[model samples]
Target: MSRAQNETYLLPFDNRIEINPALAGLNKNSSYQTGNQYHFVNSEQTYNLFYASWDSYSNKLKGGVALNFSQGMLSGQNISTSAIGFYYSGFPIKINNSRILLSAGTEVLAATKHWAVAFLNNVIPHDNDAPIEQGESFFRYYIFKPKFGFLWTNNSLQIGITSTVLHTRDVAFSLIEPTTTLGYTLYVSKKVDKRVRDLYSRPFEMSPELVVFYREEATIARLRLLAEYTDKTWGAFVQNDFTNHISTLGGTIGYRHNFMRFNLNAGMGIPGISDYNSFMCELSLNIIVPPFSHSKYNPWAPAKN
Candidate 1:
């Protein structure tokens, strides 16, 4: 039997990384930050992401850009699919206080598939409320959505709120409603102990996050609780997601040696439902670059008189 004859179907790609300027920093003293992540699901779908940002203290500014590429395939078919998107975050504004900063960003996405054209043309309505474009082979769209949020931190407590997909343009289907396009997230973190700040000089912490998603026909909400402990050399974390009374549990262990950090994560769905009840594993590696010597002419560097 061919590999395609013995394949399994899985859920569509829904996970996304929402860039936050506050979490991208190495420290208050560091000026540059960059990282990359790769994700695999059900041994079939794969995603890659890259992001980098520069910060300036004198001007109280932060700016960055990110890219996402994903590919997946259906079982028992010659069909293949992929999507590419780019994200850009502009300079952040300081909120008059040293503990708060507001930032904004936008993203554009394009995808290719054999059935996208047919689905948009036949399945989706072309009414006044649902505006779509005519195209062949590949479907291209722009999401002029702007994301803005404020990050506040003082000592061991941190809080953030980000609004994403506030608006949409050239939407091609009614199934994609404007109200459902809007996304909101709230996150809070607290350090549990001052002495246990070990993994990489960061203390043990607990965070709870809530995300509200407006769908074309319904509003969906999800909650996640995460606890982590880290030192300079090793770290570990446990996370749980609650939705519709079902909970998924996962954990990660990581180690930092010299300039490289390695992480491994495994997760399982609770109340295993059919094909969805299975274990998922992901591996990640990050390269840490040392801080550069302060330069008077570099805008990213803090000013020194």
Candidate 2:
């Protein structure tokens, strides 16, 4: 069987490196994340994916750098793929006294695919386990590619675009698998809460996010509304495939304590070509390393009169 070419990242913001290289180190502090996803397409087909990513900002380099690795397997098929990538994003460039800024980045990825076949019970004759044909038992190959991305952001609005399949070994310029996102954040805080400025006081924030990806064979779009207050988060999303007319509904819950954040997400396919049994679940954890200055100052210090 051939490799599947169409896959989407469910949580775009949390899995930023997988979606856009330009998002490397875009968060307030350096972070590392690991996650696993299980997808049940049907009784016959199942998929498992695992990934880990880390990104850090460097003042000397004036940019952010990242490393990512992922593996995927198709259950019952004995097919697997492993990939590793390095990403970089420069510091944002200011736009003429406005709050807007633009950042550009790129990544290089190396991947290997392996496929093996297993004999059925009592199928192989004695001393004839080897393939009858030459070199038919297993297949393996390597792939190398480069991707580019750009992001524009202000205080409360963000837009990003990425080209995943830009260059390959055999082709000078292959199809540009494009992905884009638009986001807006709104803050709602009481008067008393706004007056009390402290390190631990965080405003209640709600964000509406939209993401669209277009491949050569398919188009996918997602609409999500998320809310965050201090250390808790919850969100819901509806995703649709324009080419295939498939839709799914999903929700996520998360908690943050100290330097770590944990999230659980689940999705179910709507009644369509397949029954309602199609489902997916993912669990992710993020560990952030705060900047050095985070612990240098004491907010409760007394003021001199």
lDDT of each: 0.43, 0.60
Best by lDDT: 2
Query: Tens digit of lDDT per residue, candidate 1, span 1-305?
Result: 11111111221111223434334342333233334434333345433333433433332344433344434433222233343434433444544443665565554433333364456556666563342343333342233446666567666666777676634332333354433255566655555544434543435455554444432323334444445455332233332322222234556566756655555555565555423343545455555455455766785777563
Clashing pairs in 1: 180-214, 197-203, 198-230, 198-231, 198-232, 199-230, 199-231, 199-232, 200-231, 200-232
The runs of at least 3 residues in candidate 2 whose Cα sits more than 4 Å from the true structure, single-residue gaps closed, are: 1-13, 96-139, 166-203, 242-244, 272-276, 294-305
What is every candidate's alpha-carbon RMSD to the true fold? 9.7, 7.3
* Model 2 agreement with the true structure over 37-146: per-residue lDDT tens digits: 88776777677788899988877767778888877765544456576788778757788542222334443433222333334313455456443222233333334445
How much does candidate 2 score in TM-score?
0.71
All candidates' TM-scores?
Answer: 0.54, 0.71
Off by over 4 Å in 1: 1-19, 22-98, 114-136, 166-180, 196-246, 272-275, 288-305
RMSD of 1: 9.7
